[model samples]
Target chain A: MSTVLEMLSTPLFQRALLAALVVGISAPVVGTFLVQRRLSLLGDGIGHVALTGVALGWLVGAATGAARADAYAIPGAVLASIAGAVVIEAVRARGRTSGDLALALLFYGGIAGGVVLIGLAGGTNANLMSYLFGSLATVSSADLVATLVMSGVILAVGVGLRSALFAVSQDEEFARSTGLPVTVLNIAVAVVAALTVTVSMRVVGLLLVSALMIVPVAASQLVARSFRQTMTIAMVIGGLACVGGLLVTFTVDLAPGALIVVIAIAIYAGTAALRPLWHRAARPASTSEEARADATDDPATHRAR
Target chain B: MQLADPGSDPDPLHLHGVSVAVAGTTLLEDVSLRVHPGEAVALLGANGSGKSTLIRAALGQVPVVSGDAKLYDVSTRHHAARVAWPRIGYVPQRLSAASGVPATVLEVVLTGLLGRNRWWLRRADREQALAALEELGVADLAHRPFGILSGGQAQRVVIARALVRRPDLLILDEPLAGVDLLTQFSFAALLGRLHAEGRTIVVVLHELGPFAELLDRAVVLRAGRVIHDGDLPRDHAHPHGAHDHLHVEHALPSEPPTQRSLP
Candidate 1:
């Protein structure tokens, strides 16, 4: 308890916890749409692409003799991630390149470009390790501010345009038929997902950022009865995982990002194991008519089993 | 604002020699169809005959290779000449309402009210969505996750989603493809009520089983060309067999020669 209190007293720990909380809450916001659209790995692709941007930022800063070259990394990551997201969406939309091939291109191109740029900038691969694995100790005040602002924007769009985004993600053809700006809304989802990757990169790092986005949502779906519930519960689970993981790191010698993702996975496993019991407990509340309807009319349920 | 009189209104759906080709193969060839106000038209054909593609082309979902398609005199080809989508409700083919994320039946129905230039749904929107569900007899399932419902229930919810907007023209594709006979009858009766209320409907069907009595006109397509266009083709086998058979074979001959193309 004293150790936790002491950890909280330090400004570094405070900034890290704040960033984690912001990333935790916002990653799942954009993630709900991505998971719905079946583009759950899009954040990972954007993360790889952002690495190039981070390296480019470092190169430019070092060339200009800036006092802190790493400060420019976030802006660079944001631009590169957005660019990567748009390009990926365009490629997928055109249908010329297969979806997996496009993602492969993004994953390879992004990491390669980052490595090459970092070498050109006269920095060893070691300098990139912190960004890859995440170093909460190095999180600065400016990083926290950027994380907060970007997360705020993401939460607004994710929640405010829930209906439109939900329609588009659930059925693109029907959404387009309704004369919703399908293309614009699709791009908006991709852009928001990209922003989420960059926002979370400082806390969970690039490689594992998608875990923060996807695992919490997956955990929530095991018991959530509706999309609204899935989103709300996922946010709660994500925030808890982040805070819990950070606190554990203060007591144990472990990587915060890895610990956070492990906790989320544990929650998912727990949910899966308990889902049948949960369903059984809720089953008796239904009337006899609903029970008979399920037995005879609901082929989908039987097929699922 | 235009008057509410139906007689003076433009055709709800109009296609002028619209041809759509995906890849090297043509899906719809020079298809011209006009659905007048309050008319229930059905597009009928065998699989790969392009009934779905024709409707998709008319709605400007697929880019037309030549000619034009319009909704209420506004061209679908141009983005600036936007169609008043609020006046048209569309239900796609038997796509599973289930996605990676779970959605309540009410939430799915509420999406029908979206894209009408509104960012936020009002409390009234929830009531309106519930009313649509209630009309479809699936009001009890409004709070249930859409992914878990039976096919028939899901179909009703989807129809409710389409009807929530009170669209003048309802376009449904293969609404009864995979449902039980009882559900099909109920669907037919529901559509009959909507038709009696004077809504224009354009539906795509594999066979006009229960909907035969509801549809006023049938446009038959074969190999991407309109082979027959006029009154519903009489089923010689079951001339008076309305709602008697659970399944009805296509009235037209199955294997019409490929050379017989309409000019």
Candidate 2:
């Protein structure tokens, strides 16, 4: 308890905690739509693609002899992931390349590109390891600011266009018929997903970012009765796991990103185990009410008029 | 029922020599269909006969290779023409309303009222969605996950989503495919009421069961071509059969061969 209180007063811990919380809130916002579209691994693909962007920034900085080449990493990642997302969405929409094939191309090509580019920039693999596995203690104030702004934008788009996105993700044909601009919305989802991958890369690292995006939502879905409820509960779970994981790291020697993901998975496993019991407890009242309603009004007779 | 002259009011849906080809294979060849307001028409054919493709082309979902599809005289191919999308309600073929994520019946129904410019939904939207569920006799199930519902229940919820907007034109693809007999009868009655209220309806059906009395015309397709486009064919196999007998024989000998040719 003393250590946690002391760590809270330190600037480094505060920055890391703030970044984690922002990522916690934003990752699942776009993740909900991705899950609905059955593109759960899209974040993982985008994360791999963002690695190439990070390497490109490093290479460009080395080429120009900039004092701090690492400063350009986040911007490069934002651009590259967005580009990768658009290309993937186009390929999927055109039906030229199969969906899984496109994702595989992204996953393999992105990591290879990053490794090759980092080598060209004269950077050791050790420097890239921090991004691959996440180094939360190294999160600078500028990185924190970028995380806040990007997450703010993601939340605005994710929540503001919830219904339209839901419509398109749920039923593309029906959404298109309603003139919801299905193509534009599809592209938006991909772009937002890309942004989420990059924003979370610094906190949870590129490899484990998808875990944060997906596990919390999966955990919440076990008990949630509606889409809105699921999103809300998932966001709460994500936030808790992130803050809790970061706090735990203060007391122990552990990687915050891995710890956060482990905690999230634990929550999901616990929820899955408890689900049958939860349903068993809640089912009787609702079923009996449904039975009583069924007795009073026959569905056929009510619909006949 | 009075049949309005085609030259007077613009049709709800008009396809002019529309030909759709997907991946080098033609699905609809010079298929021209006009659905007038208040007319209930059925697009009937056996499996893989282009009945679904033709309607998809009319709705601008499938790109037409050589012709035009218009909604209220505005070409659907031209986005600048401003198609009145809000006035048209479409229920696609038997796709599960359930998605990868669980959505409530009300959430799915509320999506019907969403448009490109509309982002947030109001409290009134929820009420409207619930009212649609109420009309479908599934108001009590509005909060239930749509994925867990039975096929018939899910079908009713989907139909309710389509009807929530009170569209002037309703296009449904294979609405009764997996539905139970009881739900089908009730659906037919509901469609009859909607038709009586003067809304145009285009339904794709494999067989005309309870909807036989409701449909004004039947356009039958065979091998991506319109083989019959006139009155609903009488079931010659069962002259004294029940009114609800399934009529699956769409290729009637009475249809003129001249109507079968592509322009």
Model 2, A1-305: lDDT tens per residue?
78778889999999999999989988888888888877788888888999999999999889989889686788889999999989888877777447778779888999999999999999977778888888888888988899999999889888888888888899888888887888888999999888998888888899998998998999988888888888888899999999899889889999999999999999999999999898788666554543443321333322211
DockQ per candidate, 2 decimals: 0.37, 0.34
User: Per-residue lDDT for B7-113 in model 2, tens only?
Assistant: 57689999899899988999989888889888999998877899899888888888789989998778887662288888889998967545768888899999999
The candidates' interface RMSDs, in order, read 8.9, 10.7
State the DockQ, from 0 to 1, for candidate 2.
0.34
Candidate 1 clash pair list: none
- Fnat (0 to 1) per candidate: 0.61, 0.60
TM-score of each: 0.92, 0.91
| Model 2 chain B poorest ten-residue lDDT run | B253-262
